[model samples]
Target: MTHPIPIFIGVDPRERAATNVLIDSLTQNSSVPLAITPMVTPQLEKQGLYWRDRDPKQATAFSFSRFLVPKLMGYQGWAIFMDCDMLARGDIAELWALRDDQHAVMCVQHMHEPNDTVKFLGEPQTPYPKKNWSSLMLLNCSRCRALTPEYINRATGLELHRFHWLAGDHEIGEIPGGWNHLVAVQDPAKAEESPLLHWTLGGPWFREQRTMGEGLAAEWFAARDDAFRLWD
Candidate 1:
């Protein structure tokens, strides 16, 4: 039997436009059947309950806790979690193939040097070798559901006092780093060959065009109109 391979994307009501652009791009390039799941955080409903209220570094933690973990637990088979800012350039069959492995959680390494300027406003430089981008992740849902809760609990329980310790654990196991490309801070030379471009900082809508070297964005945008109509 062929297992289901679903593609998930998260979006808040505030980011509807970017979300639409992302979905349009994915539909255009995707050859396999895909599912888009929006990421919503409970903090958005409660005033003054923002990530900054707890740990500024944990800005994205609640979204993962409230939405991603639960969704993965319920989803059977393989799922690809693509950030709302990513544009797919080619067939994602390789990503689906990776999910067949029992011990792997597909992901990409962060291209920015450890001390690159994008670090949080008041956060200290990371002592670790470097960080990985969380923008695109492919997982065997069965394996992820087993560990998602534990990871979420650990991330949520970190003391607000230890601000620098708030980074999410991206090192699950032997997943490739090419799946998630960090466009802005990525090395231009390296990005030239990446399959997926993640508009981590600002996407095409805000910038009016692709800027982080030539990438799949143009093709993705070209196909958007038809793809969006079909997906809708």
Candidate 2:
């Protein structure tokens, strides 16, 4: 309780609204104080922490920047990383309590098979083992020393997302699947079972994909509206 729990979120200009709502949801549903830091690409570039060229297949600005959390934390204590397109329906303190120091990083090992060839903004969907696993992580920074600024800037997508930095898959711990429930790729009914909702395909913020997850879309819309109402 001495310090607020550090939470690093991936942020993109296009998903600013999503990010804002996510922050609102996190604080609203958390018992503990949070130190939420958005890994904004522009700021990272300005600070000389990130300088990777935009990949055509990259859907968001923070796709690669998420790997730099350990370095950002001075490779010290534990910290969390989550995507902007998420809504926290349960207390974030629960998730924070699951952080285990035995592993380098922990995340939900999702069996994400793309339901579509493209996602929001016509971004190509590249399917691979353990896709959204990196989307949410409990980073034990000292153990993740392999995630240097130089390594992050140039590592391939497979290497970064699949956790090639760690010694083996065993080093990568697993969190409950509900913490990172993928909206469209996973079952719509299961959406209600999850504490967090992830609009990996796209969220209600995007016009065309607004209804991407049917029943689950309402959750994000409600969160967004509530966030807006609070702001007003």
Candidate 3:
């Protein structure tokens, strides 16, 4: 039997419910075992990772947490990191099956621009090179020594998100776009084919956005319903 994959998810306390839904989607679809960990601020604090010292502004709650994934795995073997606001539409085991020892990290490369000026909590929607690339990553932990707690505690968000940790762009392996379909940014038909759906702006938890009733949201809603079927 294959060993369970270690998957760390960036979770903000404000979006705990959404994070839970994301977890449900991952667990429900994957046949392979998974060791899932949610990186929340309080938990990080207990682990001696004071994230706020790095981003005093707290612009994005989980902005720096993604960097901690490699370190959390003890800089050994391979692991995966994903944002909490994502839903899996396909087998996560398939994504786990992909492991290229050649690269330090594997991610869906996205050339994206923001349609809005602000994010879910009215924070500025900052765009930079290789946007959304870090949202979902297949990390080769041994090669990701640069993501140490000391380094992450001092590095700026821009430095982390802009692929500065690696020696160059070539170090990053590309994954299929279907692994990270950005809602609203992608074409509806094409998005349907994606195994992973990222609600970058705000998911169903956002009252106003939920009421707006975007067509792409139906999948998330369905996943949410299935996730909570026992409770309902």
Candidate 4:
């Protein structure tokens, strides 16, 4: 018998509602076999490796490094590490099939275009032109376990507030841009064709006044309702 392909989603428990919505969306829409893993940061006093204070951002990367990636290493299948805010536009199986190549990971390009600018550490900044996608990443489990610890250590050492610049060289160890499409900043015409839509500015919940541009906000609400059912 052929072993089932395994797809994994990671969530930090602190963002419970968002994470639940993400998992619900995948289960209800995805045709492939998948697993939702909540990546929790153990309290400093409780046990295991602690990455200094629980700075939410650092804690997130560290959880992937110290826990999630290693746990999946035992398996010989493909894995996708999705952020809680990523909502799938269609079947993600297209991405899974790309694993046939020996690439360690596949990601989208950073989407901020030439004219778009962001402020970083009080200075005007443009997106790092080189970093492959960071929002959604697909990794070979075996390869990830080998590099996760070092990635985590290096990521944690950087000042959390300055993440945009300190995010570091993606070419040193990340896949090409096509796999994880950073859709939010793409031109409106191009955005419509992307498979995954990442909420770059902030998550769905963060926009208290405006809804997510199109029908997506409604879709997110429906997914969130389904997620609540999982707990019940």
User: lDDT of each model, Cα atoms only?
Assistant: 0.51, 0.90, 0.83, 0.50
Please provide, for model 4 over 81-140, each residue's C-alpha lDDT reduced to its tens digit, 9 standing for 90 to 100: 666656666666666666633555556545454453532122233344443254566655
Error of 1 at 120 (Å): 10
Report RMSD for candidate 1.
Answer: 6.0
TM-score of 1: 0.65
TM-score of each: 0.65, 0.96, 0.93, 0.67
User: Candidate 3, clashing residue pairs?
Assistant: none
Q: How close to the true structure is residue 191 of candidate 2, measured as C-alpha lDDT?
A: 74
Residues 10-88 of candidate 3 have per-residue lDDT tens digits of 9887788789998988888899989999888778878886555645434457888788887788889899899988888
With a 3 Å backbone cut-off (N, CA, C), the pairs that clash in candidate 2 are none
Question: Which is better, 1 or 3, measured by TM-score?
Answer: 3
TM-score (C-alpha, index-matched) for candidate 2: 0.96
lDDT of 4 at 70: 39
- Please state every model's RMSD to the true fold in angstroms: 6.0, 1.4, 1.9, 5.8
Query: 159-193 in candidate 1: lDDT tens per residue?
Result: 21122232334424445555676665566566566
lDDT of 4 at 112: 51
Q: Report how far residue 84 has shifted in candidate 1, in Å.
A: 1.1
Q: Would you list the clashing residue pairs of candidate 1?
A: 10-39, 11-39, 108-177
